[model samples]
Target: MHDHDREALAMFIDYQRAQNLAATTIANRRSILTTFARTTGTLVDCDPFTLRRYIGRDARITAGTRRTERGALTAFYTFLHDEGLRADNPALKLPVIRVPKGKPRPFTAEQIDTLLASGAYTRTRAMILLGYYQGFRVSSIAAVHGHDIDLVSQRIRTVVKGRKEVWFPLHPMIAELAATMPNDGYWFPARGGRAGHILPSSVTNLITRAKKRAEIAERKLTPHSLRHAFATDLLEEGVDIRVVQELLAHEHLSTTQIYTQVSEQRKDAGIRTLAARDIPTSSGRGAASIAA
Candidate 1:
């Protein structure tokens, strides 16, 4: 990158920091911007067409990643234009990125019961409970401190994704787990970790091990599945999506709505009428004759 581009990148990073964006968000923005500068020449020089072609150049990148790249580019160009460094925001003119809609992979009801009833309170169990029962992110689960547990108020405080500090109602199950931890520092401590707590990935690995211990079939089940289950099961029980959104601390209702996709069970139930009804065949036979 030229000196001017480097200076602009630094300025944009500082702007993200001042906006109180999450560290990872800032880092990703910086990375995307720096990568563009290194691989594609000057950042501002690329028009919308060039930028679009560049982002689409790699077929291996998933649609979600492409969307993220588009967002990062848009933000950067907007920053440059607003700062009077660029005449126009080319990235802003980029077309919308379309991502395929996939149903949320919430644990099945039987699986949830099996997990909840699995005996003993290990850190992994606690982490799973925090996500399922408390609707916490993996990072929040790892960041839980002894002091965050206010037994009197029946609430626990933690910083969630996006650096949003919020308190969750201390689910009785979580309280039981918290009671076993030291009443200071990180509840899930890692001595070598810079944050003095377990890495989020480490927490995820623990969940994976516990899933196996629970005798679950090893597949694509992720730690976030518990969070999905938390949202899904509640909605299945007729809890309002808005309430689920609040419980999940989601910034947008649209995000929360992703979990509202029709489940296979519901879809099956809906289509049963089609199965039950008999349609006459060309031979004027009803469904029973066709089965023969």
Candidate 2:
């Protein structure tokens, strides 16, 4: 029984290949199946008990992790059923776990001012501003060439996430930074000439080091956090969530909806503003007392 189960797992990998699953997906399936095999004892003698035990053990892991395992098991058993072996997917019985809600954390306005003030080089300053204001992913930022920026138009055409091309209009500050930078070099230059597109790690490290130098704590500052700040700032400014979604190049509207949840403090402020207008003056207070 164990050997038969092992054979079933191997056959499933082949089926995944035939379906043209992405390499990453293929790797994950292999990992999950391998975990199942190990947890089940010898595959040749395995039974449904082994499957249940594996899931039960992983129930102690986080909901997100268990969900991943559940998905992999479902796929595995589906393959087995198609191959005329197992008739049911035991992993389907796994309970779903809810992921906690989290807001996009952005840098304070003061921190942004300080970071830009610290970077001496015009090019470095522009790169930081671009990351903060335009929300370019590191790859998109690195892809920026002297030619891609249209100063006359005050816009940059960035290749984002392979399939998407996002053109971000430069804010006045960003435009000024770009204007000061040399138009001949990679916006953030690397060595080895053309092949030396700026590495994301290099900029991430630069920001991390700069934050440390500026005495900013590790509580919230990060390179990607700047992008989140960019989007959130726009939302806070009353920009439509749909427009922000386009600016951020989010594929799903739900991804953009997360930022719409304002902080509790802000909500309280809004309520206070409304309440202030309805407060009675002295004469109105007397009229209300007489009516009561």
Please name the candidate that would achieve the greatest TM-score relative to the true structure: 1
Which tens-of-lDDT digit does each residue in 28-146 have in candidate 1? 88888889888888776677887988789878988888899999999989998999998988987788888998668887768766765666356766777788998887878888888
lDDT of each: 0.82, 0.71
Displacement of residue 240 (Cα, Å) in model 1 is: 3.2
Q: 242-287 in candidate 2: lDDT tens per residue?
A: 8899888888899888877855656887888864456545667777
Q: TM-score of the candidate numbered 2? A: 0.63
Give the distance in Å from residue 55's predicted Cα in candidate 2 to where it truly belongs.
Answer: 10
How close is each model in CA RMSD to the real structure?
Answer: 5.6, 6.4
Shift in Å, residue 10, candidate 2: 17
Candidate 1's TM-score reads 0.78
